[model samples]
Target: MKSGINAIIWEDSANKDYGMQNTGLKSPERTRPHHIAVLAYQGLCLFEFATVMEVLGNRPDASATAWYHLDVCSLEGAQVRATGGALVEATGGREALLSADSIIVPGWRLGPVPQEITSALLEAHAGGTRIASVCTGAFVLAAAGLLDGRRATTHWKYAGTLADAAPAATIEPGVLYIDEGNVVTSAGSVAGIDMLLHLMRRDHGVEASNKVARMMVAPPQREGGQAQFIEHTRPLKAAPAIGAVLDAIRRDPAGEHSVSEMALKAHMSTRTFFRRFKAATGHTPLEWILLERLRLAKDMLEYTDLTIDRIAFEAGFGAGDTFRHHFRRIVGASPIAYRRSFQTV
Candidate 1:
């Protein structure tokens, strides 16, 4: 940040524009997927694999204007078995990796990537294909010598492993994803979706990416740095009285629901409710409320045209300044910067 704003945003933005390719859903027969390849190593995280296929495999409505062609690649014609016993058919092998515009490696199984797999990845990198990984998939990339001297990230648990294996790569553990133009890496599991949606946004545009997210009935455009997931404290479930109070909290996230009044509503002594709430959700009622507010703030950032002040009120903050403070703390970015990065507008 010592550099000027222009210095920081310009060179960096151009590289970001390179690292990701967001090809909106398109017919394979039409745009031909720009050749997206998923490296289906043994024990690949199914959710991450599914995320890639679900995002990249679908052909757009014959009526829509874009398309993608997704291919599953493996080191050999080996039957790719996922962690949960699901068998995946890899239609292509190492040769397929060389034939892609983009290639992705999902988090590897509990051990190192086989040498053969690593070699294929390096050859693909040599061919100038954009490469990325989810979770420990970064290990595969690093093992192949592709990550050295680059800005990269992985599931925080394995970020240290990546740094140790490839001392040249600058490891960023807390962020959701990193884009070095030609190479990218993301946190484990769900961040894979965020990264894919980003690629779609880069290729097709905001409107196209949102359509796919809506198709899946999920939010589009979660910033790479947003919390992986928020744990909410539900009011006491065993106490029917307290259950009603919990429902009320969810119903009116923006309401002024004080803890003392909530205890009264549940007919519980304040001390008992406090203890139970902590045991149930691993957080206090206030902590849960803040997380919910952050989620709402994110939703507003993605879906609405509301002003920041209005979003603050809708998300239950006292006002704009308070909302900004909590948002920056929990979300790791300013309201405007978050919106600018994620919101279509």
Candidate 2:
């Protein structure tokens, strides 16, 4: 029924390619290809929209294989202008929402969402279509009340704002993405690539997904639970006194450090040290210590072949079991699993 011309593309030699002349083959025509609908609006993030088009729209040739049929739809099927000063000609409108197997709402500038768009999304979900948002587009889903009581995320800068706006949805601050079966959300920019690759892997298989990734020159996969790149700001102090204590902890994460000892090193009483430390770092002494140790553990896990026990000891956790507990709690995966998910090797 089918034949392989190469590892990446296969066709039926007995017929004309896969789709051609194989009118009798139900599997080739009925399944495999997914109808994906992407939303377009004024002030859309061109990069985010292009990300979806790159992954789901660009294919080998129609005769080689059919993976996805993409419909770029704008409100009311009208022409929309992108933030980058380009115009988009959409193929469909709300009707595409009903026929799509999946819908993606890329990040758009902050504004009030039209009620019609929200209602179409509600209907799509009710019909079992998977809905996803990239970055601030989580706001659109939230406005639709689709992310109610769901653990979702967006860009770190807007996490607090979205949380306050959507009290019913749980806001996860710094993850790359979160897939809740029917509803999926991703963090800013590049994380959208991670989320779409995951969906591709789920729908097709690893080989097909990897083929696409290779074409795009992107990593084959990044787990949804991977931490977003968040820069922790250090407080400005009057002098370098607290800086010395912070430097000591960073220099030796494995060394035993107590608040009292740190206080003594800084020539301050325990109470004063606690107060100033909180002011300097916006975190309690214990919290900062744990955070530093976790950072070290993550580096070792990603770059080295160290065992879990060795990584734990070097990172100051002292025990493999404790390290795993903390890593899972903070990073959402075990050390081995996290490494497996993200390690370039």
Candidate 3:
């Protein structure tokens, strides 16, 4: 095991664990689950809508004892066509906004959001409801002025336009998502899945989030700090060679694949290989290898009942001490603590 590094130990009891305000498991006046309202509009991006539904609507552990209500709402309570031309009827109108505990905007397809929807969003924010947007849906939140002066991110392809439009909002490009307290914004497509999973983790704890992720057949956490597009970094001319090396590294992150070895395999000199590799992957050879290993370690921590040393070895960290050092630096938690936080019965 790698030695000589002191790891910061965090007290689990002192850690902040947030819970939903309205689970509706027991109530004196009425039996009502905490409501999550999704904004449905014409020309909506269907995938993001489906993501919200899949993550929140169908919890595997949900039963008569554990459930949260979902509401599909829009300005007019009418059937709307998706971007692909499929029709969908909403559960209610703008009036539903008043009762929602959290509101989600999947994605805004057509330009010029209706004033009514924007107004409802603003009202909801002013009334202390949590608001989140996926992809171009950040535009809707920006229009409502909910993202003003807050750090946010959107699809990197549209980041420039959103930035130009919302000068007051800090546009952090390339990130998966950004959480600014009550408001959250995510990048394109799958990043939306990460955003909702993050909410589940924050409100219901890691165990609940992991359960939801397993049901979705997806990773429970992909720290919001991760880049939205790692493959785009490669130069077109050198893609095939560098791509092969990257694939190999991913296949065995713990393998001691040195820079010289990778360079020789790619048929490039060490200097050229370093430059080209950095260009294609947005990270240096060492950084990318560590990232992949850490990612594997995180998955093991969440899903497998393995000891820290075994997980470290499987993740290519060689020693439990080395794993602890890198895990603390990247994930901000020790391996044991991270597993403890996400541990399930």
| Predicted structure with the largest lDDT when compared to the true one | 2
Tens digits of per-residue lDDT for model 2 on 1-345?
111111122111111122123223222233456888999988878899999999877565557666787999887448888886988889899888778888999995787888988999999888878889999999999989999988888887788788987899998865777777678888888878887876775566666778889888997755334341454444567247788888888888778899999999999999999998998787898888887888888788778888899999999898899998777766655688778855664
Which prediction has more favorable lDDT, 2 or 3? 2
CA lDDT, every prediction? 0.72, 0.77, 0.75
Give one digit per residue, the lDDT tens place, for model 3 in 1-345.
Answer: 111111111111112222233433322222555578899988889999999998887665535444457889977548988877888899888777767878999978848877898899888777778888999899999888888888888887788799987899999765667777688888887889888877765555567678888887897765323231332332355488898998788788778999999999999999999999888777899998988888778778879898999999999988999998877665545677677766663
Report residue 36 deviation for candidate 2 (angstroms).
1.0
Worst 10 residues of 3 by lDDT: 1-10
- On TM-score, the leading prediction is 2
Q: Which of the two candidates, 1 or 2, achieves a greater TM-score against the reference?
A: 2
Residue 53 CA displacement from its true place in model 2, Å = 0.4
Clashing pairs in 3: 233-280, 234-280
> Alpha carbon lDDT of residue 291, candidate 1?
75
RMSD of each: 11.2, 10.2, 10.9
Model 2, 78: alpha-carbon shift in Å?
Answer: 1.5
lDDT of 2 at 245: 89
What is the TM-score ranking, best to worst? 2, 1, 3
